[model samples]
Target chain A: MEFNRRQVLKLAGLGLTATATPGLLAACSNGKPAAGDGSVKFEGWDYEATLVQQNLDKFTQASNIKVNYTPITSAQYVQKVVAEFTGGGGPDALYVYDDSLAAWVEGEYLQPIDGLPGVDEVYSSIFPGNAEAMTYQGKRYGLPYYTDSNCLIYNAEILSKAGFSKPPASLEELESQAAKIKSMGLLEHPIGLPAQLSDTWWAWVWGLVFASGGDLFDNQQAPIMNTTDTVTKDVLTWLQNAANKSKVLDPASLQLLPVPVDNAMKANRYAFTIGARYALRDYNDASKSKAAGKMKMALVPSLDGKVHGTISNTRMYGLAKDTEVKDDAFKLLTYLGGLDANKQPNTAKFWFQERGLGFAYKAMAKDADVLASLKKFADPAIYAHLAEIARPRNVLGVAWYTEFETEMHKVVQGVLSNQVQPSAAVASLAQSAETLKKKYS
Target chain B: MSVLTERRPLGDTAKAWALNAPAITVITLLVAYPIGYSFYVSLQRNNLKRPKAKRFIGLDNYKALFSDDAFLSALKVSAVFVVVVLGLTVVLALILALVLNERFRGRGLLLSLALLPWAMPGVVNGLMWRTIFDAKTGALNGLMLQLGLIDSYQAWLTSSTGAFLFTALAQVWNTLPFSVIILLAGLSTIPSELYDAATVDRAGAFRRFTQVTVPWLLHPLLIVLILETMNAFRAFDTIYVLTGGGPGDATTTIALLDVQTVLTFTDFGLGSAYAWVITAITLIISVGYIGLLYRKGNFEV
Candidate 1:
């Protein structure tokens, strides 16, 4: 009982070893990647509750994989996912926004799909640019979930009344047609585009920038705003003219976001609106929009010939590296995003009919069955054509996407507001983008 | 009176330390540990995203701060914002406190309504302001149009100057009630005899106010000033929801930049350093003000 100091310490050491061995063993076993059982916890942003449940239930029934889905909103998606990834034991599988997918790849938080069974078919079947969007350093870490791109959705009634039968083919035609519509007093501004600093508006501007072969970043992912390039100057000049000096776009466009611009079209205040092709659901829904039957789809006006640029976003399915059930999660990811969600042929149809999202699989767009399923609602050709050219930019895959987006939007807003010259705006952005490049790199 | 010098018997001393051990441990763990850990992390490369690459870079993060144009710009913006927003908030709160201190009908209702903005969270307040200032559909635009104040709606959040000014106003509104309540309590605590004495001495309203009310309110005003400065300096949520620190980097305050650096970039080391830099700035300001007050003999009240 009255042990010597050496004896006391020896006894204490023995006690600690006995107490810590089991925990140490347990931690050591868990030190490597988790090999989860077939229970799947999936996360996504803003998916319809009932539809998502239906999909999860379907997958569960087919695969015997117990599944749970949490529908996080866009605002909470990154913070929650990053926390889960860093802290460990997060969802087994989740839909990732492309902006943060690269960050995850950089962090090695995703399980590569390059060696997964039947991955070749899943890999080859997806639309163009989708795989590239999820790829970092030549490894595919995610599959395309759903993709949406902006096209000019016009008010057919207004266009017809203004003496034109179809949407404008080129940027000039767009301006002239808009002027005609303005002169006819059909609307104060004929074309509606979101001018505010948001991803929604950036999509439109970015499309034009890409069309003219200009990019915000160089091959090395550095900021390369070229004020001298016709690509950059023309885009800004057109925006300036439309917003301030011309009747083509109203001053209101400078202040409007995607929703209000759509609303203005719904109210028949403008002839054309640049937005996701999926919004055709709302545009054609009589209950939601006043111009229900009047909406028509067309490519956004090109600077030269065909609409060569489209700004699109693809939701991706990434398996959390820490998941115990990596294989099961991959199964779930492929099932939902890869092969029409467990070969449910109606998956694409359901997405198109319910949520207005396009198919990830290129073949799904051309599938006779899928087209037949949607023939009652929208034309098959538009979705198929849009899918053929669905090229979305991989935003700086670094953690700086959020901050860069905020400033990028402001730069576009400046151009729209006529507060800064086109050259000045680009120059200002060059500095911020440089900072972002440095921060994220 | 030296507790260390007046040492008791060994058992007594041991017992005292034993009794105080829990409190001391809790303080160390809760307060001392985070502060010390933050300083350590700030000096290292502890980015969670790049965990394997993490290593001590020895004040490289701090060095990066000075050359960082964004951080420097954010600091400048925060300095201006703190002065303007805190000035407007304290003055307005004082005015309201004075008005409410007067005996009036429905003072209870007015006070309740005045506290409404405070009751709401910053996010909700920012959202409400967003809707109010929305260029196309906002009530503000509609009212201005109806009043013929302008031909069309102005992009209030889309202009740098307008955004900074409006965001400052929103900050003042969000933080005013607390300052008002403090100043009001300070005003009420001043004995009525002082006012009575000033009245008997035929002190005019302005003279009585400057001679009696201001000096009496100084202590609470200093508290208000300190708290308001800290709160206004760290504003993020409202600015995020409202202007998003934009129309360009016009409103990118130091606090917002720090949060962005950490949360957005997932660079905890750099973010921790940014947070400490802000802390140092605030501490310096607080210490300098306290020192000035002490020197001026204005520390007491």
Candidate 2:
């Protein structure tokens, strides 16, 4: 049909409206009957957008706040988030790891959030790891949405079949148990540790160093990696022996990433593996794992035979200081991170039950229903023990923490592979750490 | 030179400039702008991780490179990777191209098979090789064990030397297909009369190949060498997937190191400096290839 210019313009307008109407309706529906302009944008890699929308719909309904959730791949998101914030436009809030908190704070991308409404009550109520991690210059800059502390997740059935009812109490006993399990041919790699850079073998290195009373550096982030730190060498030697001499560590650990190690545990290739207490929820999933309902959680062995310590990891949601709508963003943060009647945040249920993440809410972890849900999969007591004895996030709180961790992984791998001796690796790392110290300073 | 240049010089040139304006603008925006910005960034002390501290530190980032151990080691690794991969791939591809160019049944299928690795994405190629070289679960180790070649599984990716060698091997395998296709195309262009003349002059197979094939293949060989050298020098994806630039930074080539510095550490200034050094090296090698090609008149019709 031939159309005049007026008719064409009218038809174009109609088409555009038809195309955009659904999105407009969805946006209006997302904003409940709240008084203010209730729109907040969340940007992150870890939590999927649909999952966040599902749980956060309650906030949208109750408070009339609309959340525009955007999920990006972790690597891309981490790099892009900085540019977005620096260029004066970005999401109202962002998900960041503990290592990156110092950088974000240095960049002035986060607001001092401790004074926000409802934050004071829950700020100190979350896990100590979570609480301390969000603090910078003695002021909280973000809210910890979830926290993870290292623990030994063991297959109870596998250990019981090998005549061990409970997991070992110390590294020596654990090594001995691994040897026994190996000798009995009950399991191939009794302790599956990923020596690869992508997974826990590197974290386990730090955990042992901490447990054995070795510090990475002092408050100034200087080079403290010396022979005086005997525990550092001892930990490295023990890991070397486990991997190369005792044959406890799976040789394939050097080749596989985290998923493969987890799968190996489910296939009963391991008696136990070192992982976060938060992850036990997934390890015990009947449909997804063979070790479901047959697993238990215990403290990562105290390598020094005295101190029981483990490294903690926390993920926080930081409010962009430049966000146009600060109140709405603060409300969204509270909705995701603040304590509820059960003291668990909306994300805690989704992260723990759906993704097998652990909760940082101490009261909720001990709450009757939460404990019951946690006990059905893995030991909730392990988290209680973690709450009691675990060291807070002890890594260097420098803007260059990511670089420091990466360099440490290289040094640790060098030692594990016999390419560099423990002493030499430490010496190299000392030099490297000093350079980092100078750079960051 | 033409009458057209003299007849309507100023107006014609103005019209020509106007006509080419869009293309020039596009090239500047897409290509020239990034190159200029990268150089500008290379002059600053800009670690995005320390965004607040960024400043125009001029040449200091370049100076830091000389004292950086990891950067030096990465350059060394990149050099070695380039040499090993380029050497092996060029020789092997030439041989394969020669064989495929010969009269033989199933040559069509063989030519298609020869270019298969080039068809696969770099990530896929790296992962495929990673699976085969896995210490315990790999098919290579399983077969070796079944053959009683060794008593236990070998940790091929654990040691620095092993990781370096395996990463180079994967790189060579991935690049050989492109080199072979180029060399094969060059071979097809050679006149059969020259080979006939060489045979008539009592030239042996090796001698004929050296005297005739080598000379005729020089242009394409140089092009392939230049490209593959640059590729090997800056390879990131395959090495990243296979070894993650590790076993204690043993396989961390300059390209991987640059990426780690820029993206992972968010040290933009230092990362750009790393990039400039790589670009300079690539430029030097490419210039050398072009000079050799032109000085010898390899492109002469």
Chain A only: TM-score per candidate: 0.85, 0.86
Alpha-carbon TM-score of each model against the true structure: 0.87, 0.90
The interface root-mean-square deviation of each model, in the order shown, is: 3.1, 2.1
Expressed as tens digits, the lDDT of each residue in A1-441 for candidate 1 is 589999999899899989988875665353434435456888887658778889889989988888878888765677777776776657888887777777776676777788886667766777667767777777887777677776778888988998898788677788888888888877777777776544322677777676555677765556667634456667777778777787577655645667788787778777876777777777777888898888887776777746466666777788877777777888787677665435543455567657667767766676666667556435567656656665766554655666677677767767776787888877877777777667655
The positional error of residue A55 in candidate 2, measured at the CA in angstroms, is 1.4
> Using lDDT as the measure, which candidate wins?
2
User: Second chain only: TM-score per model?
Assistant: 0.89, 0.91
Superposed model 1: Cα runs more than 4 Å off: A1-38, A183-185, A189-201, A218-229, A247-257, A260-262, A305-307, A340-346, A372-379, A394-404, A430-441, B1-32, B294-301
**lDDT of residue A79 for candidate 1:** 73
lDDT of 1 at B99: 93
Q: Worst 10-residue stretch by lDDT in candidate 2 chain B? A: B292-301
Binned by DockQ into CAPRI classes (incorrect, acceptable, medium, high), candidate 1 is: acceptable
In the order shown, the candidates' DockQ scores are 0.39, 0.48
